[model samples]
Target: MKNKFTLILVLFLYINLVNCDYYQSKTIVPHDLPNKVTHLHFYYFDIHTGNNPSAVIVARPNQTNEKNPKKSSLYGTVFAIDNPLREGPEETSNVVGNAQGLYVSSSQSEDVTLTMYVDYAFTSGELNGSSFSVLSRNPVREPTRELAVVGGRGKFRMATSFALIRAHFLNVTTGDGIIEYNVTIFHY
Candidate 1:
């Protein structure tokens, strides 16, 4: 009876150990690659009138242009450096990554909402070519916004984190602006 009880207890302990996600007493070693730091420039044009060529107006039922023309959506790519009015991407500049997403706002409304997905690629670093993705949401009109780090690849594989976004320049007249993003990621 004693031996049978001991065997059952040992089997239970083994199963629990195998099913556990992490071991408490195990040593956690740091990753071989260093943390990547990047400051990216997010530029938007004609944000107020939504007149930029990239901007598109989505239509909804029972919505008119004068009232609620659905919402104006704009999407474009961003760079690692701060280039407000530049026409295209600068190759000489450090190409960290790109942001391809859109923002929408009501007619004649100052409050706008945005959903941007930012992907980061290290150009020259210990973890070069390794990339991570951030899903950003702007729920209201504010000077600063926060983004969630959803996932990643390569050295940043399975990473999760967040970011802080601040508007560096916003031209109410031309409806152009430059936003800065500071991201923090946690990975294996």
Candidate 2:
């Protein structure tokens, strides 16, 4: 009886071990290369927020994409913008948009340029009061030439005092986007 019991216990252990290995192998192997993460971080801002007004966004890298079996080479960054003028109480002379500082993780490759863009719905207001412009001072240099987009909706009446803006940043690897940034508001 003891011999039979021992035999049964050994068989159970062997089966479990084999099954565990099989499952582990299946889970560990990838069927194909990983897709380069196309999107990294995004920023949403309410323009109605009182002046000293401005919105800033930063993209941070995540680590889940590093060990994938298949991967793509890093490229550049890209951005899209959307904004339009609005009807305002006054001919507000707010310049409305600017993008700068496209940098990369200190530990990763840095052989790329950053791209930014803006698209918007037209704001119907006093020519000067409801207007929008989008520009970037300098492009970021990194391995991936992905894109980062920023822009807003037009029309800022008393009810719609500000615009809604969205920005997206991208990277090639999980480690590329992880970053530290500072947003400053300068007022006179």
Candidate 3:
């Protein structure tokens, strides 16, 4: 009888532990940007060259260059984001993370169409190393664009989320700007 009682108690404890609600549901996080610098590399194909007739190219590397050559087809950028732009990242100034991704522009017409895949990462804070990916359309031109959060890692494991992208400052010529991102994620 004693052995049976002990086994039952152990089993009950195991069950309770397994069923614990340690990881809850529906977590919403917002990154407010008063003046967050957005570093973007814009790759453009020469219309005269015809090398890229479609004018489709990849935005890469991750740095900021206003005097980037028009003929160059590759670039990099680093967005420094902190509350007041003074608190940068641990390694850098106030750079919390980065907005890295690809951009595909369809045309230069008034009805411009673009597809973008952007990834957001947190370098410091409780959510350090956590990142989320988003697929957005015409995010730059649109007043409010909703990006689909496909997946994530670290603290955001198995995260299903969305990002609201608002463009505050955009240099149409340089293709650089300061944008705001408000992300809502559901994770385990």
Candidate 4:
């Protein structure tokens, strides 16, 4: 009887271990190469003028904080955006996509700096419904900046690239800007 019980227990352990599908996992590199590379250029409109604005300040620094910068630098201000993307720098130009996200002024320097989180959602092309994400720090006073293309979907799936952004036109009084973007993307 003792020998039979031992044999039954050993058989149960063997069966459980032999068919353990969830016991381990394996890592693999993609068999397909990342051979598709594309370049794109567009204009991003940050319209803050008129009755209908595309971007608006949602939060501001405490007025009593002496260390906080004023509106000149916009430090500690957060803006929510649903701006337009155009084929040309002009606001009336053809609309191709939209940029929807939020940005915060995080720099204490005299020059305005923003930590931006935005997504470029394409609307009117073969790439319609596809979107790519940009999360980066932008120094607005600088002539040029490079933003990271963190991730993407649809035609831009598994994308890894950067965007060169520059202020094409800026209205200091109203805080409006038409920025240009040159993007390079690589995907499988």
Predicted model with the maximum lDDT = 4
Clashing pairs in 1: none
Predicted candidate 1 versus true structure: per-residue lDDT over 1-188, tens digit per residue = 99999999999999999998776566745565455544434332223344333333353334345555674322222322212222223324444443434433332344556554556555555656776776767643587788887888887787877777666666655445555666677776
Ranking by TM-score: 4, 3, 1, 2
lDDT (Cα, tens digit) per residue for candidate 2, span 100-141: 223322323444433333332232223223222223322344
Model 4 agreement with the true structure over 121-144: per-residue lDDT tens digits = 999989899889999999888898
Candidate 2 at residue 128, lDDT?
24
In terms of lDDT, model 1 sits at 0.54
lDDT of 3 by residue, 1-188 (tens): 99999999999999998898876665665433122222221121112113322222333454344565454332232222212111311224455565555556543344445666656666666666877666656535778777777877776676676767666555566554455566677765
Per-prediction TM-score: 0.49, 0.20, 0.50, 0.82
Superposition error at 92 for model 4 (Å):
2.0
Decoy 2 TM-score against native: 0.20
lDDT (Cα atoms) of all candidates against the true structure: 0.54, 0.31, 0.52, 0.89
* lDDT for 119 (candidate 1): 61
Report lDDT (Cα) of residue 4, candidate 3. 100
